[model samples]
Target: MLTRRRFLLALVGQTILGWAKNLFAQTGVFLTEQEAPEAVFPEATAFERQVIKATPELREKMQALMGKFKPSIWEDAYTTFLAKKGGEFLGYAVIVEEIGKHRPITFVVGIQPDHKVHDVAIMVFREPYGGQVKERIFLKQYRGKSVTESFLPFQSVRSVAGATLSIHALARGIKKAAALVQAVYQEGKEGGW
Candidate 1:
């Protein structure tokens, strides 16, 4: 026994869900493997993928280092690419995805060998409100920032007027990725891991 009001509500809910699914499907592979390397390392002649597994000890250390936990972006393993030019190391590039408002935003972050951010590019931005995050003015602020820097939204990191959440999520994701590289790749390599 379905009331008219109940039927109408169900129909609307289904319609919204279908629309969201279609939107997500359309955003598949915003940044392909070929393009990511080029964007992260414009002068690189080759690149290598290194997978860092997040063991229990590693996860605990990351949590301590970041001072905050974001389960969505922090996974059990991360695939980071090392860009090289004629056998000389150029830098590192990592792609991270974080929840923005109701959907996910994917971006690629490039870090120099000195641990400073070289650039950040928005690969997939699903939220319609914060498309401005892709603008150079906003993304440029992240350049030269490192894991040692404070990435607090509206504090160390400037926030967009209408895209506060997106900005915060991007900053946080970048910080996490940088920290991962520092703790796992750089430090681990030095420690003879």
Candidate 2:
């Protein structure tokens, strides 16, 4: 036996879900309303309103726009989401997990699809000294290069020479971010990923 309040609440949830489905039918993305438990990926729990919403129309668009990338259906799914929401896929956040290109510390970064970096937020800094590497002075170097797909060689490409650890941390974060973007791009390759 359900109470009237419980029945109304269930109805509201279903309505919201239906509306979400319809919105994604047109847009392919939904801002996550709250943080999530650790399940989607490491260090990626409780993010800003950023989530994927897939639709038939969105999938088709991703297939056409990024056909050359040879992405999988899943990638298409994500890309479709990004493109439909907006061509840049800006504001999608990820949690930094490794210490490649940098050493002795791991940090968190916020990035956009067009490769635009939002913030190089340091979630954890286990380094010697004042942790100046935790500042944007080193991380800001990654702005605009988020779409490079692969780590740009320190030379030939612009970087903050002064902040070595921070620069490397940003680079490593960028590299990780590029992999996510590339993963979605590659997903349209043929099968699903």
Candidate 3:
């Protein structure tokens, strides 16, 4: 009887553990690659996709602009969308990823022609909690921010109560995005550097 009871208890514990794992492993895909640009550039009538490679020199410039070296932000290549309205260039949008707690959070950062942040949208949120980071109140803080601006928490950027990690990840990701756009499309460079 003792052995039978122990087996039953073990089985129950294993079952509970499995359920908890599944609960936390859920992935939420709020937007797709195509839809993200439309959401970020609502008024734009046209969007041209461009694939930019990350060369050694470009990476070095990005590092200098970002003021830190984060490998996760520097992929082999980046897919960007150039938005236009009636033949007028509006801005660029780039998709970036950063770690939130344990999993990666995908964000679509829209940058204006002047290099300021136009908007930020989350494409995929893998963490179980901290979905509140997607809320407008948290993301709106990024608008109008430039590569020269500070993304530090509680100053230029606001932090969520339980989503501190996610917020920090987003701040870093946005700063990286701004720096990328600056390096690729600096003022008066013409056709980018």
Candidate 4:
């Protein structure tokens, strides 16, 4: 002889228990739907801003790598990178560390002065697993490409002996990493920064 109120209570109780069990049993990773709110960053006088959404997978992968190396990047040393409230930010760059076939590779890429390879620096293209990337002929071939080349026909790019695969991956990673920088640079240039 359950009252109507009692029946409703029991239903709620069961639902709560079921939800708890499901929550506790889930072993897979949890993905955040939206990124947390960002802290207030400094503003510029005339420079426009370009912001890109950071995918959860990309964020996680970066975090995992950062945790493993606990490395200190240049930005980390400076503490802040916000431009002054004037048209001063003509270019910006991001530091990305990628796990290549051999070892971790770090590089700097931003909008090029002439638009091809844009101001890309070899930085630390360290590899731990292979030696082919250390070849001179392979390294010299990357000097002339313009950012406008688009790197579409990757096959046209020269390949290193045993380092072909790693070089390709590293090159692609550098391009992807430069995307945000390019956006910001365009904005800054448009805004007269």
For each candidate in turn, the TM-score is: 0.74, 0.41, 0.80, 0.42
Candidate 1 CA-lDDT value: 0.74
Model 1 C-alpha lDDT per residue in residues 1-193, reported as the tens digit of each score: 9999999999999999997776455344456755876776788888898878878887776666667646356676776889899979878888777787777888888888787888887778778566677777878888877656766566677777767878777877777777677777777554211
Best by TM-score: 3
Model 4 error, position 107 (Å): 1.9
Residues 83-113, candidate 2, lDDT per residue (tens digit)?
A: 2132323344554433423333444445554
Total clashes for model 4: 9
Arranged by TM-score with the best first, the candidates are: 3, 1, 4, 2
Candidate 4, residue 165: Cα displacement in angstroms equals: 2.5
lDDT rank order: 3, 1, 2, 4
The TM-score obtained by model 4 is 0.42
lDDT of 3 by residue, 18-114 (tens): 9888766546888999998887888999999998898999888887877763645567887889999998998999888888888889989998877
Off by over 4 Å in 1: 1-29, 69-71, 188-193
> lDDT scores for all predictions?
0.74, 0.43, 0.81, 0.42
Give the deviation of candidate 3 from the true structure as CA RMSD.
4.4
What is candidate 3's local distance difference test score? 0.81
